[model samples]
Target: MESAVLTQALMRPAAYPHPVSKVTLIETHISQVFLAGAFAYKVRKPVRLAYVNFASLATRHADCEAELRLNRRMAAALYLEVVPIIAGPGPLDVRIGGNGAALEYAVKMRRFRQRDLFSTMAEADQLTGAQIDTLGRQIAAFHESAPVTGHASGHGTPARIAEVMEAALNGVAELASSTEMTGRVAALLRTRAGSLQPAFHKRLASGHIRECHGDLHLGNVALIGQKPTPFDCLEFDEALRWIDTISDTAFLFMDLLHSGRQELAYGLLNAYLECTGDYAGLVVLPFYTAMRAVVRARVLLERAHQRSAAGAITTAEMATTQMRCNDLLDVACFALTRRPGAITIMHGLSGSGKSTVAQRLALAGAMVCVRSDVERQRPPHGHTAGGGDLYAAAQTARVYRRLRAVCCLGSGAGFPMIADATFLARGHRQQFASLAARRVVSFSIVDCNADLATLRERIAARTGQGRDPSDASLQVLALQQRAQEPLGSDEWRHVVRVGEPAAVE
Candidate 1:
């Protein structure tokens, strides 16, 4: 880290547009920032690090130029340009034109108010739901339009991430001795690494990696004209910048949850999934989130050791970072334990609109809709009381078994279940109710009621259109009415009149 050259470089008049009455130097682990009036300039230290390399003066200048170029993709108004400083050595005492040869380059940027950063906004409680949603849309659009890279180049694959994690841990180990907590953390990382291998291999084969914002989190986001915008993407390493889109977005999601905004985290995730139709990517979220948290923890730990005299964060802040890291690790472990199994039963007679309602609910969450009508309509599975009919028996058994299986799976995975079915017969209703009761899980039976004429007309229209699963005619509807059993006063059965809002009781 040679500061004499940089100090002289900063003294040149070409570095500043206005008179430099004073120059404030800010140093971080990787770079030195110079704050001048109305502008800030960053100069990468000529230091080679394991995760990032800025070893040579030429490489540092090239990286500074690359940073300006890449960041302009998202923040054109902020990244002014990279300017070369012409200087002559004299203990760094020089002015804009006061005698100097070409020395070095610096990334000049428009200085934004500290309050514009999301971290500051969050501290002030100014980060709102609308802003989160806006960020979701922005990131979604960014991912949609970002360049796609070849399988070998994309940095999002599991193997690549594992390598990064290993490198990061190596760096941490180099900085500190092995302790009980570090040992546990290392073990957990190994387990997560193992779990992601298969999935990572699949992505590698499928070429799911693309160019992404390598570093995305609250601090990198800012409000310009009251609009949340993402900026400061990592431009130093092409390997770090190209990654799985989910891996890119996971950092923000983890940060949100860590900030005590779990609901917003969930909302942002759902929104992104909906926009991108990357539901399958959900499986990899917890792993990426934990990795991001650990990375932040490592950075904060380093910061605790090197904080400036007056601006250093308190001891409590360091402890909080440790706690947050532990919490994130726990979340990652919990997610690994979850196995997807979900079932929704659509229960309602012909013309009751139970299928319609079930379809709507299914769109909001991850659940498989099992329709009795569809099951019954399968070839020989049609309504017939004949014990010899194997297809009929199998389909009936499958309908019941599928419902039960889904309920068990959803309960175990901690997901909400919506069982849609027509509970006309007491025995049929009891079967599901009993299963739910045994699991101590919530159940809602939507017993739909409508005017007889209206029901008959709806059934006729459905039959004429050939779109409805139920083949029941008017006569069958009459039979259904005669056989219908009233639901007893219970917490689970929710009897609602057709076209009316649902009542929980």
Candidate 2:
């Protein structure tokens, strides 16, 4: 039950009851995972960190139980059970709930291919926008089902959020490039926190605070048979796990931004709002996102410190750490300082580069783009996929309806929205214009224009690739051209031409 003995036992795969082929040991700051045949055993390290306590065998055992209980909510099949490590004559062995005095406890899990991880998929470009959309809905559903912490629980209140932010910023200030940058972040946090207090209090009153997956990022999710499953939630600290739903999701959004996947992050946010109908939650999202960035900086700083303490730090490595720290600081500051966004609609046929411009706007952090193609392909819950009728009049109407709803939701959340669609119909364009007017937000229509030959060529090329969300082909493009309505005089004033300069307001 000593550290050395535990390490030795984990190193030998034969110690486990399962058939042993090879033993893969993965270590983190607070735990060690031994992946053997058909299973992964996660054993907590005997470290009593500020946020977690796993120092004693009894404590680890209870923690393992908690991990099993909490993670199963989102990933039931993966979290198998908690097993005990029993002492033996020659070596420590996993008892699998047999009768014996246990030395330590490990959370057992069904082993999965590392390649199926969301992070790995992202690196390989195998993660689709539709999958990201599904992930948001799943998270929203999870939050809905999760037990809400009572207001009296003293968790997830505006005061607590401010307290946590101040503590986290103060804790990481020493690692910042200068005290001035730290001071600026603190000031921004104070201002944003004060502004967001009312929204936070409202969320707390409305039961939006619940137990959440505190560490939701690409790494904690995996594609199991094409379903994105999130696991390995923070089980050690209730304070960390119980939070406003948007704040919890901001971690994933901030991670995507950090990794340069801002477009997907924006789509995920839009889809989450569509699922949860919590548009007002946007008021606190910037603050939550900044806090997540600051948390990432704190972690990176801790890593740099550990390397420095060990006398193993290299100049290049130190430089990389410092650069990342500065980058996160900048992101935190940017999120806090972002201007209120306006609604923009991409108005053009598929081959005209409407999606491209929409994505550009989203990456610029101007607004979240909601695409008609992706949403059309996504079937409702318990519904089967329809055929080529996706472009039929009724189906097209449904798509536009959904698009309008999503735009309204985003606008209500105070996020600028971009409707990425052909918008070939004046009625559809007017619907969004009306929504913008009602929402009291500025509106603009981006008309992507190209020659007929160029449009045909682009559509052909896109169809050949077969990876595009759009299914439009030359025939479809022709049909669209014939049916498309030109922008009206009123709509022309709001149109921004993408290709050639046209007379505009």
Candidate 3:
């Protein structure tokens, strides 16, 4: 359709009640988009394909309406109702004539500033860690509220995964042959496909499938008044929309890594896991992320092909694309096979830098630190006791029990658990060692010791900063010193004198 015709169609009362003096056509390969006033309208091109079909005006209208309905689930306030435009005798007529003949349908939406998108924010380093945590919680809640279908939806099944893989391989092969994605990339794609087929089937049987946002990426997310909101869901195909939940999340994770936000990527993944409690899904993430990356690579290659004659798909550009594909495939391989494990326990008196060290180690992905100070402060029987009532043996036993349980669980899940506690006695260390032995995992304990003056200074500084959780007064520290026992020869223990960096190292 001509730009004028499309503009006129958008101006119809059925499309937009308000007057629009000017309209801008945003041309995309798959759809004809128009920006009218404060609203954006999208109309699919008249084409029939294997994955999507909009061959007729009626089908396009129905799809438009479908898109409006589905996207409203996430962006309800943004996706306005769809409107039908009728064509008459005039070439660009939008009003109804003798018979109201439908000309086209437009998917209307609230216009958002392009610069407010997550992709732009990430490029500017404005997508903070806190924002990513919020995004994780929001997406977790969305997935929980999303509708779940039966087996007939063709989701979470071996056949469905096979179909998706076959389609992706076919698309990649066609793009590679027509474009310049040859040599290492072509070989890597084949190798990844072969390695992933078996795991795909296993995941299908494990009921890891759900209806998901098929095309989740940075561009599809926008920050509206500082909150990340996802929009423009893929409504053209049910098969594409219904997929493994991990596969859905992997798209954004891969996109983040591709955009050079590995820290945020890891944080997002960790936040999502903490929220959804889906640790089992981690095993399938690599394969899903790899597939998502290759899908994008293939789409980029196809775009390159369309501009081949314009020198856009040059030999050098093709090589860059190949390198990206290889990198993604390598990440997938490493994610699937490499199982990282390490345990670093922090033992010290109150205000000895255990929490600070634990925080740094956790952020570095070195260990999952469990802080006893934090755990002990938790309710039921925390630090409310006076001198006579404080340090109850039963309370100490309960804290140790909780610590051992968390350590065992983390170790069993393939992540070394770092237990941060005041190991004042040999019994305390022995309890953790027993638990590690039961799980067939190794444990390392680092004893942190500081002078009385240094400990007092650190404790005062922590209190000034409002970060310390301990109630260790000078009297409590003196009591702790008297109660503490020296460590004997133990292979797992290492003594580190705090505030003396050279000696510790």
**How would the candidate models be sorted by TM-score, starting from the highest?**
2, 3, 1
RMSD (Å) of each candidate, 1 decimal: 9.7, 6.9, 7.0
Better of 1 and 3 by TM-score: 3
Give Cα distance to truth, residue 393, candidate 3, Å. 12
All candidates' TM-scores? 0.66, 0.75, 0.70
Off by over 4 Å in 1: 4-15, 19-26, 88-90, 94-100, 174-178, 205-207, 306-505
- Candidate 1 whole-model C-alpha lDDT, 0 to 1: 0.66
lDDT accuracy of residue 208 in candidate 2: 84
Q: Model 2, 1-505: lDDT tens per residue?
A: 6786788877776677778888898766678898989999999989875567887888889889999999999899999999988875675544444668988888999999999998888777777778988999999899989999976899988778877787789767977676777789889999888877778888898888899998898889998878999999988888888988998899888877777777778778867865665656777888888899888888777767766876868978988988888788888898888654578888887677787777767756747777888877877545787766788898899889878877775566557888889999999999989888887789999989877877888878878999887988788887898999999988888988885522110
What overall lDDT goes with each candidate model?
0.66, 0.82, 0.68
Best-first order by lDDT: 2, 3, 1
Clashes of each: 16, 0, 0
Which one wins by lDDT: 1 or 3?
Answer: 3
